[model samples]
Target: MSATTAPASEIQPLPPAENARATRETASSAAPAAIRHYLSLPFAAVLAGIARYDSVSFWPVAILVVQILLAFLCDRHIRAHERMEPKRWAIRYALLSAAAGASWGAVVVLWFVAAPPANEALFVLACIGVSAMEFIARCRFPYGYAAHAALSLGPLVVLLLLQAAPSSFALAAVCICVSGSLILFGDTIANLIAESDKLRHDNIQLIAKLSNETREALQARDAAEASARAKSTFIANISHEIRTPLNAMLGMSQLLDRADLEKPNRDYVKVMLEAGRGLRTLLDDVITLARDDTMTDNHNDSDPALAARAVAQLLQPHAWEKQLRLSVNAPSTLPRVAADPRRVRQVLLKLTENALKFTDHGGVEITVGVDEPDDDIPAVHFSVSDTGLGIPPDAAETLFEPFMPGDASYARRHQGAGLGLAVAKRVVESLGGNIGFKSEPGEGSTFWFTLPVANASLSGATDDSDADAEVTPPSDLTLLIHTGKLRVDLALSRILESFGNRVIFAESRADAAARAARETFDVIIAGTSDAEMLAATPGMRAPLLAVLFPNDRSPASGEQILHWPAPPRTVYAAIRDAAIRKEPAAAQTRDSQEVAPIDASAFAALEKSLGLSTLLEILQSYIKTAENLCENLAEASAAGEWDEAGRVAQDIAGAASGLGLAALTATARGFAQNVRNHEVEDAHTLRNQAQLIVGEHARTRLALASLYPDLAA
Candidate 1:
């Protein structure tokens, strides 16, 4: 697992010089401790020899004293100069190791020579065994281990060989072999440790190098970001300065064009306005480029014909100024597209203006139509073609770059900063549209874009291209159109106003009710779900003409339902007839006061037949029953359920007639008949009629007490 580990075959034995250097490091680190440990044996032996024999062991004491002094001196020398080069530290370690080896050897020699022959032989065996144990214990060094083994075993072997016996020579040979094998084993271990040390040093260097590279990369990125921010701030300030003067130019030129002038002079002023406006847009794109900003899409249902025709109208003056003809080629059959009208107009206007700017003597054409469907998602395509200077070859690559004038001279005459094409490309891409151009030199260029379409909020119920004559309301009918989208609100208002009704705008039912109380509105056009909210507002008695869109499940709503499709005007006749009122003002006023307090003859006859008390109780029951029937009939009629409304209306007629309320009976009969004929709008009038009858009944109840003087009480 360690990076320093190598296979047995990969590990090479250290050479003599390196082996000696490494072994000396191990001796300086660990040999002095071993020498001090050996001193303990001398102390133990001296104590035991003095205790068992009645004699003092001066030699053992002397040897122990010398061993202690030698270990202390060697420890002090190693600590004095701890940090040393390998070669110099190796020489110093060798000298200290040799002293430790000789000191240990002297202890062995003293034990063998001074002890009795019987004990000396056992002591010599103990020395040989301890030498082997020391070699195995301190396995980390080669040179230090070799010197210690040699000094301890060499003198003992030679002394044994001098006995001139075959057995002594054999013992000497075994000692020699043991020392040499131990030195070799220590050398191998030292080589492994040295190799691991080198690897750790190399890895540290590599890590430092990688860290430095990562730090430099982060610094470079921060610098680039800082530079970009500085550029954006500078461009934003500069564009603001340029646009101020350009705005003045555009305003002055517009005012001049409006003033009285000759035809040629007016055309010149128009050209000036177009150039100034184009320069302002170029400045806008400069800020966009620096900040990488694009137009915020305000999505709405926009008609292709409206956007194209609007742009065409805007560029007509500039086209005339250049003596070039400009036209819009579009069909009335085009569908309304869900798009941002502002951006669409911007793209169309800029492209058309560009075409006019490039064309010298020929015409520029703008065409719009539906492209081939992509998986049933509607797509609208527009192409602007110019008969002026076609793009040169070199300009094609950087055509969409900022300040890119395909031909410098033509761009200079056109007088824009030249970011129009680039900004247009960004706008198209942001809208998920495709934009490009096909140009042929000496001919013309056609710049085209394709945008995916979605269904407009207004349903495409029919494609009626013909605009009908405006409907003039027979009476002054005020209408409120409640919707958010401008195009939808405008289109619906135009359709309703075609009948010549004054239509107004309202944010909500409460707002409409407040305005209606102050101003007269004959009808409110709103969603059916808002029926309760609309009912809560005071003074809104007009029947709601609920507008339905695509995916609307409720087929019919209210006394009239206006289903707005392609041409909102198609619902003209139904919406008008339901909204109109046919009632005499004087008769309605008189009926409200006199309808409820019927002459007492009707109650008088019933009171004579029954008792006065019984007649009064019966009259109360009849009023409660009639009120329920009238409310049910109104609800059913509003929902366009003629069958239910008629059924309830019959109950009202029977109940009113049986109770001797002649006016209510007559009104209920007429109301029932109107429901049978499916003239539900008349039901609202019928409802008003029943309310008056109910009001008249309340007055009659009050009159009985006032007139009969509680004949009752």
Candidate 2:
């Protein structure tokens, strides 16, 4: 017989991915077989070869035992396949396969060398069984299977053919046919393993893609939030800028009574004061609602009776000013409802103020009572009605739009930002209530709301309402002195000084003017009786708030004028309201409603948690990172990395908003959205807008500095 070497291409290697899958399958599939080979191979060899008791039989038994040990080692490696890194794994695996296949071949070759011709049947049977298994389990990678099959069967096939006999040749033919069948069958399994691994790879890529997309979406959302925050910050600053001079004008007009001014001059000052106050209201309206509504804290439980009383008391002043009767009708035993007290009061005051603002005659009435029970929770009802010209149908639908004031172009005359009703509607809905109105064109209009009382109890239940905190002035308030020939200056100084305020007196009018030019004063004490003198002086802009008084009831035109022997209540009110803007009307709008240097109280808890030093460090780090992110975003945009820019913007906005830097957050939010959506030109424009908005000394940044002073340094 002629011999031929099999080419390297006889076995098509498995793909890299398929090899891994085959390794794992090998571990699990080889486990039971491993136990069988480890136990049975040596046992079978010893039992079968012992009767012969020859060197050949002994060597066959030894090789069989070694093959069993190799099978056990391969089982251990396969079991730990997951723990092993794929690097060099294929090479290690191939070596193990060659060793395992050669071990089996050595035992088969031993059979011919050691056993007598009578045991040839045993060799044939062993060769057939071993070749079948190599094809079955190891077939996923044809290399391992082919190695085992050739090694196990090659010796037996050669020996059978070398006999030169008919029966031996026929047996060899059967063996060849069986080997071919196994090899052909192994090819099919190798393809299946490759396909399975390919699917797994595709699934892994899909999962990674989804994770990336989700992350991008989160970043876009955060950026949008920054834009919102930026908007709030910008509006707050703009409001402060607008009201600075307007407050000065109002202060001047309020001083007209004691300034010893002429009647026409007094009237002119009164008109100026009114117009200034209206302007301040517009600013307040914008600033008050500029923040995210969800971010604003709201108390959602209060008594309707108390709310009615507060609103009626607040609006009664307006009613008196208009010479219209104001009435409140509330039940003696009304229950408390789940609702925001401030929002409820705001809604009632807004309705009442609108009623008085429009009414020329008659009166306004506010009523609070329990409405008919439509549900188990019951409802607390409130109504504000006025005998004013009713709302026209054309105007009714739009009355709840922000900045939508009723007809002033017609015979109607009123001043207000159209946010009250809109805000009222929102508050009502938030409290799980419904608000509506009924009006007759010539008669009157009644605005009413019904709120759920699920958590409410009758008036007899113990009230858990917290008393309002008392307001007190801090020690050593700085005051500017402006006095000329009046005993009241000394008395006023003593009163203020007793309350822990430091007073610096100007020796002369010349000195006072010089002091005013250089220093900012919380309040100014002026005891001059000259209206003409003050009318010519330029009013301070959010610097020195003047409180002037005179010798008698004569007009003294100063910033905040009071008659001689000024009432304590009058003096206190002047001081308290000095910094506050006059709301559009006598509406009991938010007190301390000036652009207050951020309520640092908001940071008290945070400071306590992180420690002031740690909090400051985090904030400083955040600012630096945010600035870098902004720059990188711009570069990414230039490079057309919109997704990357969006991600960065999202990060910037999230950090800024977390720091309560609304302006930066709002700006970043919008810019990020534009970037994510691939609005290239719009995104670039928005990025510029954000940079302009969040520059150094930006209002939001300034406010943040107030919160963390060390951050500025």
Q: Which ten residues in a row have the lowest lDDT in candidate 1?
A: 461-470
Error of 2 at 502 (Å): 18
lDDT of 2 by residue, 379-424 (tens): 9899988898887888887887787765545222466667667777
The residue-level lDDT of candidate 2 at 686 comes to 60
C-alpha lDDT of all candidate models, in order: 0.61, 0.60
lDDT measured at residue 295 in model 2 versus the true structure, 0 to 100: 26
Please give, for residues 190-220, the per-residue lDDT of candidate 1 as tens digits: 5665556556556788889889988989998
TM-score quality measure for candidate 1: 0.43
Candidate 1 regions exceeding 4 Å error are 1-85, 94-202, 219-223, 260-275, 295-310, 320-348, 361-382, 429-434, 450-713
Looking at candidate 2, the ten consecutive residues that score lowest on lDDT are 466-475
Q: Give each prediction's root-mean-square deviation over alpha carbons.
A: 23.8, 26.2
* Top lDDT hit: 1
